[model samples]
Target: MVQAQVTRREFLKASALVAAQVTCGAWLTGCANALAASAPPPAASDAPAPIATPTLSRELPFSGWREVKYYDQLASAVVQCAQCPRRCVIAPNARGFCQTRENRDGKLYSVVYGRPCITKTTPIEKAAIYHMLPGTQSYSLGTAGCNLACLYCQNYTIARAKPEEVESYTMTPDDVVAAALKAKTKSITFSYSEASVAFEWMMDIAKVARAKGLKVILKTGGYINEAPLKELCGALDAINVDMKGFSQTFYDQVCQGELKYVLETIKTIRRENKAWLEVANLVVPGYNDDPKMIGDFCAWFKENLGDDVPVFFTRYEPAYRLRMPPTPVETMERTYKIARDAGLKYAYVGNLPGHTGANTYCPKCGKLLIERVGFDIKQNQIAKGKCKFCGETINGKWA
Candidate 1:
């Protein structure tokens, strides 16, 4: 085990920083650990005074939450939706599959903006981003709702909830940026829930965050349409796309989504060269961890996304509708070998932290370039994005 130990209180502190950032400087001690809110509005250029808002410290109104309009009206009074592949033709008062977007009287509004149900400051490594500013903190934010219904959802409590059941607060896009600045975090991550489901809120925040020079990392399922994803790509700094399995049958039966769309999203990220993209494949015990299947996935990734792309073989835990046994550590190691044999340069195991595979090594010299004990960087051998031992160019953002 890598032994990256962090106290629960420290985790709470990180969560507090994330919450304070999302709430626009609103700090209430009692329920402060709840939802992650959006950044507060920016201050006037000439005004020296501080911009402050009344902090309603409640569990509801998760920060970084806001409604958006992404549809355009046609001559026949019909609106074309441009959010996800499931371009839900929502009628007035209807909601999309994610159950967050509401079609109110011919217009669409995201109901779960600013208010988030699942709010916690987790290890950035938990986001499985092994590269792009390693060993730094990211203010994680998300609201309730998901576009796809994966049977093995670890966060179904909030991700699958209706807007009515979860507590929410209103934080504008500016609020999200302000929170990022106040926390002095290395970056902001759209995670814990499906970011694509909250496309407008995430897209808006990414633009503002980029202007402030804060990196935006997306932890997504990669089940989005091309155009909207392309639009968001320009503002994104890095992305971790979940590739559930290698087959369409696995996607259809296990995730209630499509495999090709996710593959397309990964391809778009690489083709556009907009974001530093990584892939995570959650290996369920009996479902998608077959040796041949893993080899095919690694082979495809090597061919399309390249061998330099980081791939994480995440272990599965029983949750949501699926109550299968937890994925074995041996299974993770086995898949790692399969991927490495398939010509993938960077394949790591996750969820069982402290494993040797969690570390990053240079493919050229076979030296440990980055040693991570959980989320903490115990040793770093790379300097300025190159291997220190042999000057091998590391394939990541290394500033």
Candidate 2:
């Protein structure tokens, strides 16, 4: 049977209904029930099911750039980008190091505004945010371009590309919020690509999402400047920062960014107090997997963010520019132990599914509070934001 075509008006009405359900706290549970009831019976054929492409809004013509924020004008039509640590000073008709922002007539403009290359609804845990709103879904999106050039970037195809080099869908702030509501996701996540490259777009969509009572989460490398990071944090509800490594030398050689700036961004996020923060450290073999370095990272995390902040030691896989052997599971487990030993209460091992380290336990009583297999949460015993067994309050947006 052919599916009936949906007009824009009908789509808007449906989105409004879903938004209402979300506001009433009924969307997630209702969606779960609907999925179970509509489950298909076993099929004999082994052919893969066709994937459905998301129907995006019509492309909006642009003048190729929009006025940027957080920059300063310099001598002879040169503009200094204060967005990130690089602070690229562009001459007339030049672009920043990220290649997303350009200086047109001495005025900095973002070329990637509202042009997203990816959009989907994913589990919140996939963002490596194992604590906040566990088992929930988020509307995730990303645009091409990134401030940092990490050798082992998994999304390097888009992250390292200019806006003009990728196919993107045009979405305004209203369009993004509408899409999130239609997807029935609890939050909107800026992910995959470096969100800082598309800063204006993310900030605008985040503002709209917050106005509509939806949360905003950021998955970033945390290489942004103080002013911009503080402004973005105002609308953010949760953030997962990829810390990369502990040493400045490793950051310079492997990520093409500074360790100090990322650390400053993390500290700013904590100081803002508007967002719950989590950190991830990808352990690359022969690069930054030293036990002493891991221990120092944990100690710094404990000192700055405290013992309650969740940290994940993720196993690295060969991707993009890096072709080293995948990080061993034992290495990830050992790193996890180092964090735990350094006075961190919540530490986990990622990319090694079904390992006991992926589970969350009550800090007070050591009883398993949240059990997981990969990004799937099998059991969550957090009641009223406290451990069910010990009544110890967990630090997260559990609702």
Candidate 1 wrongly placed segments (more than 4 Å): 1-69, 72-80
**Each model's TM-score, in the order given?**
0.84, 0.85
Model 2 bad stretches (over 4 Å): 1-64
lDDT of 2 at 203: 82
TM-score of 2: 0.85
Model 2 residue pairs with clashes: none
* Model 2 lDDT tens row, 29-72: 34444455556754658422222223233232447457898899
Supply candidate 2's per-residue lDDT for 352. Answer: 89
Top of the candidates by TM-score: 2
Error of 2 at 206 (Å): 1.3
